[model samples]
Target: MSETIIAKRYAQALFHIGQERSKLEEFESELRTLQEVLRNNQALYSFLQHPRITLDQKKQLVNESFQSFSKEVIHTLNLLLDRHREEILSAMVDQFLTLMNETKGIADAKVYSVRALSEGEKKRISKTFAPKVGKQTLNITNYVDRSLIGGLRVRIGNRIFDGSVSGKLDRIERELVSNK
Candidate 1:
């Protein structure tokens, strides 16, 4: 199976288990902690990714590292590791976060700007996009890229709207060049 699929399966199984036990929030927290640990510790990353290490050893290390986690979390980790599916940790984390956000009915939107957006600017953009996109709330993630030249890019799910001044200029230049 694909790494993303495996990871998603693991995350979904764990999310369901947590929901069944009425510990969904805690499960999300434990998964977030694990994600941070992986992000911050390169050694831990090496250990998890190293194929030379025996599966048993990796499992033991994972268990030991997250020993403080709740029983449910431990069991889920133990189960996934035992299956030798640790490589999907990153995808599992992303899927888990997505599940949490979807459960809360939060839609994600990416806002690309040439500069940092102030709170007021973000608010205004959110208000503007909310009407256009028809989402009740916007989980707007801001990105700064001077290469955009001016104006902004907005991605709402699979839709890409490029209203940037640079984009317009490029299109006009292309048309003029082609006409010539």
Candidate 2:
């Protein structure tokens, strides 16, 4: 099976387990923590995937590293490692968060602006754009991007609402070229 399909399957199974245990948010937190750890430590995955390392050794290392994590999360990690699906761990976490967000009627958005947005600005942007994407609310993460020149660009899922000056200029250039 493709890695994405496998990742989604694992994510769905974990999501269901979290639902059953009334720990969806807790699982999300744990998965995000795991994601952060994996992101920062490139060698960790290398160690897990090393040909000479045994599965038991990898599991033990994971268990020790994440001793504070819930049993379910640890078990899921061990299962993935056992199945040699370590590469899909990040994708699985992303899928799980996506599933949780869908259940909660929320969307994760990245807002790009030339300057840092204030809390009020973020709230107003969320209120204005969330419904456009059929979501109740947005969990907005603002990124200051000077390359935008001015204005904001919001991305949710596969959709992008580009109100940046650079974006507008590009659109106008395209229009002019097409008209020529």
TM-score of each: 0.83, 0.91
**lDDT, candidate 1, 1-180, per-residue tens:** 688888888778888987888988998898889889888988887887788998789878977889989987788777777777767777788898888877765667898999999988878877778667666667889999798999999888887779998889989999999999
lDDT of 2 by residue, 1-180 (tens): 899999999999999999999999999999999889889999997998898999999999999999999999999999999889988999999999999999988999999999999999999999999999999999999999999999999999899999999999999999999999
lDDT of 1 at 43: 89
Error of 2 at 128 (Å): 1.1
Candidate lDDT scores, in order, read 0.82, 0.95
Model 1 CA deviation exceeding 4 Å by range? 130-134, 174-180
Candidate 1 vs. true structure, TM-score: 0.83
Which whole-number lDDT from 0 to 100 does residue 93 have in model 2? 96
- The lDDT, on a scale of 0 to 1, for candidate 1 is 0.82
Q: Could you report the Cα RMSD, in angstroms, for every candidate shown?
A: 2.5, 1.6
The count of backbone overlaps in candidate 1 is 0
Q: After superposition, how far is residue 102 of candidate 2 from its true place, in Å?
A: 1.0
